[model samples]
Target: MNKAFKYSYVSDFLNLPEPYSEGELQKGLLRQMKDFILELGGDFLFIDQE
Candidate 1:
């Protein structure tokens, strides 16, 4: 059997909602995602837009 563990900070971050319009939220998410990829050594690639 496998046990699950959770981080409170990650939970809190995940629970946050986008504080903007749909398009704005999408833009923000995309920007953050790109930053995340780059921060993780720039080896990630986004293959889809939806």
Candidate 2:
């Protein structure tokens, strides 16, 4: 996790606000599903979210 995130992360494109909760982050990502998927590249896929 440390190697992947490198102690920080970015999602300015998603327009998510700062000091957000886990639920808020998840919802914000889901709201921009297409953009997130594209950002993930062609290797990953969005099958389903629970």
Candidate 3:
């Protein structure tokens, strides 16, 4: 089967000011976890220490 999936995500909420690192981007996304899940079509869960 040839299926496609997004290994990563992009969202306005994750847009940092500038000069940021990958960790910063991730933190931003987690900070807005609710919206992030919705952005992912509301089919996501936040499991800590993943």
Candidate 4:
């Protein structure tokens, strides 16, 4: 049988403080996610502008 998986949007996982610049939030979130995946020993492939 084939297995299916789901992926989450990065924005949804991030809980940023209000009044933050969008650029800043995006950069912070990406860094956070990268660290988390690394810590978990999971592989990550980023596809920007998807």
User: Using TM-score as the measure, which candidate wins?
Assistant: 2
Off by over 4 Å in 2: 1-5, 34-49
TM-scores for candidates 1 onward, in order: 0.47, 0.48, 0.39, 0.44
What is the TM-score of candidate 1? 0.47
Clashing pairs in 2: none
Candidate 3 global lDDT: 0.67
1-50 per-residue lDDT for model 2 (tens digits): 55877867787866777878888888877868956786888897777764
lDDT of 3 by residue, 21-42 (tens): 8888777867787556657874
lDDT of candidate model 2 versus the reference: 0.77
- The candidate, 1 or 3, that scores higher on TM-score is 1
TM-score for predicted model 3 compared with the true structure = 0.39
- A best-first ranking of the candidates according to their lDDT comes to 2, 3, 4, 1
lDDT per prediction?
0.57, 0.77, 0.67, 0.63
Q: Which candidate model has the greater TM-score, 1 or 4?
A: 1
Error of 3 at 35 (Å): 6.7
Candidate order by TM-score, highest to lowest?
2, 1, 4, 3
- Show the lowest summed lDDT stretch of 10 residues, model 1: 7-16
Q: Tens digits of per-residue lDDT for model 1 on 1-50?
A: 33454432232333336454667656666766776776787577765556
Worst 10 residues of 3 by lDDT: 1-10
